[model samples]
Target: MPDAKPRLIVIDTDPGIDDAIGILLALASPAFSIAGMTTVAGNIGIETTTRNGGRLLAFAGREDIPVVQGGAAPLSRPGPEPLNLHGENGIGGVALPEPVRPPESLPAAAWLAEFLLDQPAGAVDIFALGPLTNIARLFIDNPDAARRIGRIIAMGGVVHEVGNVGPRSEFNLWADPEAAAVVVSSGLPLVLVPLDVTRRVRASREFAQALRVAGKPLASMVADLVESYFETKTHQESRPLHDPCVMLFALAPELFRLEDLHLVVNTGSTEEAGALTVDGNGTPVQVAIGVDGPAVLDLLARTLTAA
Candidate 1:
């Protein structure tokens, strides 16, 4: 008999440190069938994010997953400089061995459309951990196909917390505000995991230290990555594993509290790019507002350590 079908998750990402953690968690778990991954420019350029994603798959011994290169810049705004927070090479500069596999021939947007369009409706769930460039492009080019997506769980924006990139914006949406605006208004079922709740979930140094003592290579690598992320912060003693939270919530939404709200992304104002506005009568989306932070960290540590 053929293997049972696990839920298909297609990730559109920029492989920052947290992104690496999220990918690894998905690979470790048995509930997900990673249909494919498409890289976009956000934490870094598409070239580097694509390479890093390939390396990550190799690191997890799952190189069969198709990786595709997506947009290099935003639709309308000039791209931001690859921030140093993720180190020079996006995963805190920890050298992952070169991947034996290369990305797909078609650009990410094209590949995503072809794959999702061919699948049965609601067969694919998109986990977007970076800029919405590739996703917005797909929605624009093929609205009918885009609507067939089961759901989209995106890690971006800010509900009540202060922004990470600018005074009013988070990095992923800010990197491509025009794309984000399109996505939020696309009427696709989107669940926004903003910085509001993500910042509350912190993986502490003690947990990382314990992981470093694990006898596995992946656990050691995770420890190093977590430590490097902590090092980038001057004020915080613990690090927020942002992208992994998105994966976790996708796997189990009951773990977090969500609110339905109509949202709009500010794409027109250069000075206020990526500012998210919530209104009673706007584009509807679900926002994750509360999470069991300690439970999540425990789950993350256990999962990565076991993997």
Candidate 2:
């Protein structure tokens, strides 16, 4: 019998193809119980992200989870125009059936505040896979509620690799640097799964074949999504499964080598927005600098196949 209680968590995401994988991975794992999902504007608009969340929960056969819509834009300035990398609907041209349910009526930030405040202090964790707009809003609207979270594991930035958006920006951080700054300064425990480690991992063709052969509806959907995403966006046959790394790391941190960094996000200066500056006195966030790629991919394969 399992001895430990499942960690209660909320996923804040934009539902990129990778985001779908991440959600499924977390759902399949035994260590977590997803309290809810909050959708924000990043890879796509809030409406589409909210729809994707509902569809994803339906796919995972966990429709009891509520999907809530959050901020449609950034904290201060506008985010970049939606990119074609995730397709028009943010799923790389693969379509899932329309969700049976709709998003919750309460706004994402408000719902999150209520949910977090209701939980015991340090009882809930958050996996943020999009722009930090919703997170910043939590701090702004209910700063006390933010303290209830155990930790935040965010997927953003590029320390060693060249930025995918600007010379210094990853898409998520670039989408809302001001929001990132707010979250960093909110005095919460943050773990960043940045591009430096995520880039080191890729989804192999074997795993794609395995997903296709699994024959389950969700597996088939994931296979199609992965195929389309890699073919359309990547130069290599394999694509970086960025978001799933965060899920894997949460389940087993021993698979990763982390470094504690006192960091600050550059929220001003268009040229420098989203840039991460390391300083001895900046807010502390643990950054994954190395990961066991094979182990993570193996875990992903097992989770998707089992789900």
Candidate 3:
């Protein structure tokens, strides 16, 4: 019999270093057919994130896949990232040649709606590696298309862990609590890979070594990025690989354990506006709680360096 068709997927990304690594994993894997890459502003500016998408496609020989530009800012409450958060140009100041091909002309939300309508409802899985601005826009502009999404597996929120931004918020959700509120309440199939789980997938020295020994330009660059990530931590041996965990869970859901929880996303005007909390009356969603760390690390190494 002929092989089954690859899963259709759309990756909404910010191209942060971890986001770049997740993109790399998606490009290398054959189990999924990447329909398109949608860029959003999170780790840095929108322009840089869009460019990083082109650069990554060039590195992975997947330029045929469309890179469409998305939201420049969040749905509301626009603010600056922590100073020098992801370096000057995002991706930690890594050097990559400008991509010859330009991003698709249509804006991300419109492009996504058009693409979804062409496919059967519930056939496309969305890997959300950044804020939900673009996804929220899709809902706002095209509610019909939003219903077609199979699932939105997003990397955001923090259950018990301290917020990466302020006392009660993670960066992605904090960047746009309004967007997060929209998606969570849309009643779609949503899986949240919050920081409580992501902090466990650290880039060990051994994992970085595997990338360096792969003898490939893309892998080598990723290796350097991983090492540089630890430079500022000084006290820690490894940094939590954030967005990549989203892709890892996508590929190997059996390796993770999830819980059904109700979440309340604060969208008010106070400092806690972007905060995510648990309450019985909040939106019900699946939140990842456990993962097989070694197995995920192995998958990352093998897929990235695979022949």
Candidate 4:
């Protein structure tokens, strides 16, 4: 670990297979000091994701960190049925030990609001690894706290790559277009890690071998889970690691090309809801356009193996 100051972060997540990878990455890296995790509804419901957060933390031996349960659904419209892409329990069906600790008593927004207010201006960054519902509500329900945030490093939206949901929608934003709209329009500082860049940085089928060779508990467990994920995925040669890439950017923003753009989300259209459009009149934010894929893959592999 370098002697540099650690970045204090609050992770907003919905723990799927990739989400598990992302959270573990952060915990492994010495560059970040995770304040806590706020769980939202995405790959699964609040119940499963909240539980999964605790399980991941316990597995990582960081049970001291709190897992605060966020919104069960989006701002408006019913959320898509819990996705099976992550497996029945939303962590690739790998059975981690039940968490010895439970979730925080305060709801996601309230805890986030208090945490934000207590911190100095721009003291803590937010890694939004899931849908924007909890984050959007923080801006809507607590504007003062929202104003003090350092930045929102999010993994959603897609510029050049095809959408994961509809023709223009990614799963996170599509899960709650209304919330995405609110966050985009709120004028908070944001760095978006969309599919355009995440698709470029991936783990191949060989990643499992690397993890297994490391022989560390975290690495070995992730290896088993990822191999399970590979069973259902295409192109086993290259698996786009979405959430982990977002966390990586937080550690090394210099590795990516971030461009400031006025971006908008589609809340009015049914088919194109959550679609991100580059509009001059939209909110100005930093969008990651390019990255050194090989460098990122190397760093991730080195970290996970050493973790």
Top TM-score hit? 4
Tens-place lDDT digits, model 1, residues 1-307: 9866688999889999999888888887777899889999988888999999999988878889989999999997678899888988999978798887999999988888899889999999999999999999999988888989999999999978788877779888989999999999999989999998898888777878888887677777778788888776767788888898888898678889999988989886665689898877679999999999888877776776776
Each model's total of backbone clashes: 0, 0, 0, 0
In candidate 4 the C-alpha lDDT for residue 237 amounts to 72
Give the per-residue Cα lDDT of candidate 1 at 233. Answer: 79
TM-score for candidate 3: 0.95
- Output the TM-score of candidate 4: 0.97
| lDDT, each prediction | 0.88, 0.86, 0.87, 0.89
lDDT of 4 at 152: 92
- TM-score for every candidate vs. truth? 0.95, 0.96, 0.95, 0.97
lDDT string, candidate 3, 171-225, tens digits: 8988888999999888889999988888888897677888889987667777877
Report clash pairs, candidate 3: none
Using lDDT as the measure, name the better of candidate 1 and candidate 3.
1
lDDT of 1 at 199: 87
Q: Which ten residues in a row are the worst by lDDT in model 4?
A: 231-240
> Higher-TM-score candidate among 2 and 3?
2
Candidate 4: stretches off by over 4 Å: none
| Candidate 1 stretches greater than 4 Å from native | 1-5, 232-235
